[model samples]
Target: MRGLRKYLTPFAPDQSGAVSVLYELGGIIVICDAGGCTGNVCGFDEPRWFERKSAVFSAGLRDMDAILGRDDRLVAKLVDAADKIDANFAAIVGTPVPAVIGTDYQALKRMCEKKTDLPILAIDTDGMELYDKGEEKSVSCIIYCICKGKI
Candidate 1:
């Protein structure tokens, strides 16, 4: 008999949902995970992936990166990408790697702010939850960021 799988597909997780809402918002959306999560979101989770263009990217987290909790590298990559591209805003979507490693998103946001003047937002999706939860958190964060003049 086929063994049971711990992870299921057929739907995007919270991280993907967070990215989806910000897809058309003229922002550089970064998914903080390995490439597989990005592929799933782009290939399956996101319906407009083929119809439109977005600046969604994967952080390309490696074993060392996750184990050491290297937020600096992630910040550097985001900064470089942001400098190379023109975006009205920037969003950092979290995933299992970051969640498992306890990455500091608030600090990352501050670091990104120091490097770039563009408005920045972060969705703290841990990948263990569903899509709607991510969407809700992201949307609320966007509003909060705007209200606090962080965006």
Candidate 2:
């Protein structure tokens, strides 16, 4: 059967929603993708993106980095960005690339902590799911981090 949704595209994924959850918080939001996911979140998914300012960024994950599990490189980039910006915390929102590679978010958070004093907020999201799933995970993680005194 021919698809009738030529004018439409895939709905906003969980990754973008995860970023949106932290939009108001004064923290560095890092979208763990090659690049486009951040654009989508800021340009399309996030309605308040234009009206407000946040420290959202992309990890710029390359194919080799994902395949080889070069998490130290990611930690370096996060530390560099954090150094340049004033943030109270840091949130790592995962995408399909990291999910496929089984990125260890807990380890990443620990490495980031060693590099910087900012608390780490992890949103475990894979691009395959819907927006609500990511938002839910993000909220849950934030609550968990807060209760555990990690954030």
Give stretches of model 2 more than 4 Å off.
1-10
Tens-digit lDDT track for model 2 on 79-143?
A: 99989998889999998889978999889988998999999987888888888888899899889
Taken over the whole model, the C-alpha lDDT of each candidate is 0.87, 0.88
- Would you give me the overall lDDT of model 1? 0.87
lDDT (Cα, tens digit) per residue for candidate 1, span 28-135: 999988888899899988989999989999999999988987888988999999889999988888888888789888888888989998877877888888888888
Q: At residue 130, give the lDDT of candidate 2.
A: 86
Q: What C-alpha lDDT, on a 0 to 100 scale, does residue 85 get in candidate 1?
A: 94
TM-scores of the candidates in the order shown:
0.91, 0.90
lDDT of 2: 0.88
Clashing residue pairs for model 2: none
Clashing pairs in 1: none
